[model samples]
Target chain A: MRKILLASLLIPALALGGAGCSGKKDAGESGTQLGGTVHIDGSSTVFPITEAVGEEFQMLHRGVRVTVGISGTGGGFKKFCSGETDINDASRPIKEKEALLAAEHGIGFIEIPVAFDGISVVVNPANDWVDHLTVAELHQIWMPDSPVKTWRDVRPAWPDREIKLYGPDVDSGTFDYFTETINGESQVSRPDYTASADDNVLVTGVAGDRDALGYFGYAYYAENTDRLKVVPIDGGGGPVTASHTTINNGTYAPLSRPLFLYVSTKGGERPEVREFVKFYLQNAATLAAEVGYVGLPARAYELGWQRFESGKTGSIFNTDKARSGLSIVELLSL
Target chain B: MTAGEWRGVPNLARRHWQSLWLRRLFQALTWLGVMLLAILLFRIARQGAVWLDWDFLTSFPSRFPARAGIKSALAGTLWLIGLTALISVPVGVAAAVYLEEFSRAGRLKTFIEVNIANLAGVPSIVYGILGLAIFVRGIGLGRSVLAGALTMSLLILPVIIIAAREAIKAVPQSLRQGAMALGATRWLTVRHHVLPGALPGIMTGVILALSRAIGETAPLIMIGALSYVAFVPEGPMDGFTALPIQIFNWTARPQQEFHGLAAGGIIVLLAVLLLMNAAAVAVRHRFQRRR
Candidate 1:
């Protein structure tokens, strides 16, 4: 009887497996006949864009499987350097330490700037006193060992209430970008603020507290505009809000950073991976915009394609000169 | 005062009042749990009901929130739990039977028993790391459904063994004695009487264990189950994603619509869990009735 029951269960499972196999064969007949898997793992911030691109790419080529995983940027790099993944989606450029690891593994990569993500400073909708924050003011508020305690501390006329701070956790690429841009060093910040890895939790924290000031990806602020008020940042030029146009035009200043896709040189050798990368670059602009990220300029994409086509390996962004804050177009030209 | 009057009059009245208060307190606590669950379900249903349509069940996940579905995730979850159940149930039950009936009580048995209890309390992510080393990298399964299933099996094996051991122990010792006295060998007695008596309990434990496996996300994620799988997995060797991972991915998205979709996924997951629990109840009822 036990054997009979097991057999009965196994039969249905086998039937379902058969159905799934047949369904794949049917899908394969409808598109370009490229067959293989493309594995991508990386930053959660860049996941939406890559997921969108991978979805459309798979629709066009049904036999090609694209699997995108979010293990954060650093974790993804570990796998990428170890040759476990074909592509690494990163919201920031590869760091010096990560580059060394890649070199140690003999894993060369071509960096492709996919999108622009602005780190938007936000406050609760109820607080109306704030207008715009200069880079220096931002530094004063967020810098380590600073003494800004209340709204009056940042500016006398703002308010007298205690100011609450929130931000992405240390593991986040957003946190790294925000800290580096605002505090003049990566991962440096006052330790009093509430931090969360999930942007939604940060959103909720800022939205529920009137005195809360938080920073996260522009997409999050865009999603919760009604509940949150965005503070425009003044970078030497003027106060510019993080809009699509401002971010794309590089007017969003230091807060606007380019997102990237680091393709392994060895994985690029596979025909499926090569074609998928091509598909990704060609469609990244549209898909990135659709997924609430600022698309790179057309010229940037052209230059990126040229670099990929020429089999350019290693990181151009590894140098101090590149880290001095060049736009994607400028960096690509280099 | 008389001894009976001293014991009964005010003392009985105070004891009665205390019992009534305790009953009311316990009743209120139970209702609180039920109310909280109801509120949660109502909120989820309100948000997700509009999104949980036929297309949402049948189609694969998409970039557009309106088109995103749980087809691949649902299928992957079924495959994972099924495979996990197959791998863990026999091994877990055998270990339980050996420990309960066959193994002699000694230092080694006691040590093994204590370790199994300790293993059940270890964090799921630690098992994930172990699974990543043993299955994905060591055995070269490479983030496939088989790797995920093996990891989940490791996670739930202790729970199943403990539960099965309790169930098998519940079988009356007199039945085993009767079977042996009737000239049946130890294996035959265990097979015909002991196991039959314990089957209902073991089935319940197995079903509950599988339900737990169905909801796990961390171990699968550690083994590299991709969140964005547009195609259904055709075999154990294929890469897949589970319901919790998909729901987590949706909830983490910047779009508000995806949050609603996550609620829809949760509803489906809850329904699967409810059905599995119901099956456990039904199986136990049927087997108990037969006995």
Candidate 2:
């Protein structure tokens, strides 16, 4: 009551009246007893899993609330290392320098593999006869320096079509991976492709236009299978379509990567954060697959639970609070 | 009246010489300001020069940030600015001309004037969402460069219209009075006497609007400009990228090399902006001095 009165009194003084409060009311209403807010942001690719897991986690653990924001992978990491979020949903692993930034900020986090995703190559269903494409053809289509202007330019025997393209924006991890795998560099792509941070937009673009091709997360393609066709990416020899089986068996090429959620060890000691992470690992598998992401083996969640349990005992955690001025170059070189 | 009185001002010259102290003080302050401005521009130019070069402008981003060129971004910015100018200049000038020369002082005109004034302060990012809704999604333009240009035109329109009005207002009333007296219609008087006088000021406003549009990151991002474009765009509708997007992309990367690249991207952008400003100032001054 006093807090509410104080807030009312202080309202006019707030040039920053629109607060960017990260606390979730349903999760953490108290400044004590696991009742503080847990803010999670990053990776539209990992957003579905994070959102699904966060919703269920909050439902199960009534006292702990979680909110997830999808700002792409690199964008999420920037906020994560800035200490804006307690957990970050990342499509790719923390790069050498990102790890150092977290260390510099005294933020030690536990990296847990939540699920797996296979980046899917989608084409308009109107075109037939084309089933597989080599990495060289992908280079022809996506490489920054490629001179190929049309589908026939890619392969002269194919019908001459003005190849329309769509893909993720540069800040996306999937874009980085596609560029690395296809163009032999990260963040390098043919500028001609229609780009968006949202995968749904890419799906719509590919589905609406004939002679168009796009790449996005497999789940989007799966959901829109009736409207769009999945082109098999040639993995050296045979064509490979991203499936639960193929992706799990490691046949989806370099684009198949593990999705992650990093829980802050320091923050996890708090009841709400601890309860939320515990609830997350406890039900993540079934709920993850329900949200169209591949679930990991049962043993993984069990180990994570054990770690979370050990964390309360002050044994399983190495708090970054003690490491002031930790060498960034040293940590990154590791 | 005949203007021959200034030639007989021998005694008036001595009186004017008494104004020398004020002129000397003004010159001193002016020199001080000029020095300060030069220093500021020098600092900005030097910092930006670290990243501007032929190779730097032409290369695509690599793992090593130093190797990345802003060719696609430069190309995209040019297309966006050129298209934005094409849409805005004629439209904004026409609106200004109508408002100044045609629209009588009335309720509707006052409403429009107030609204245009209010629009000048409307946050740029609002235009982004508007573009997203109207151009990208609603009209199904779908993140095309045309959509971005249309959004930018809306952003800079207020400033152009306002500047154009001021430019037309600054024209001597005698010029219009003379043109009308010579048997010209109102339209003819404005076209023959006013527009020629206002062109330099309109160009100045245009160059300034283009400057604001080129540096704006929010609306463009909202309308879906690419950050890592690989190829140069050839048409208005082609998927495009720009300099600010490239700078943002590089700044967000974890690599140290990218930080340098971000700084470099900033330099290239500033140089283009400076060039545009310098050209506009020269044109405006040239025209003013000629008249």
Output the number of the TM-score-best candidate. 1
lDDT of 2 by residue, A86-205 (tens): 777787766667777877888777766667678888888987846777777888888876787778888878778788899988878888778876886778888878998767678878
lDDT of 2 by residue, B145-242 (tens): 78999999999999999999999999999999999888999999888789989988888888888999999998887665654444555455556778
Measured by lDDT, the strongest candidate is 1
Segments in model 2 whose C-alpha atoms lie over 4 Å from true places: A1-34, A299-334, B1-291
True A-B contacts kept by model 2: 0.00
Instruction: List the global CA lDDT of all models.
Output: 0.88, 0.72
Clashing pairs for model 2 are A27-A64, A27-A65, A28-A35, A34-A272, B59-B69
Candidate 2 chain A — worst ten consecutive residues by lDDT sum? A313-322
User: Residue B49 lDDT in model 1?
Assistant: 89
What DockQ do the predictions score, one after another?
Answer: 0.53, 0.02
- Alpha-carbon RMSD to native, per candidate: 2.7, 22.7
Cα lDDT of candidate 1 equals 0.88
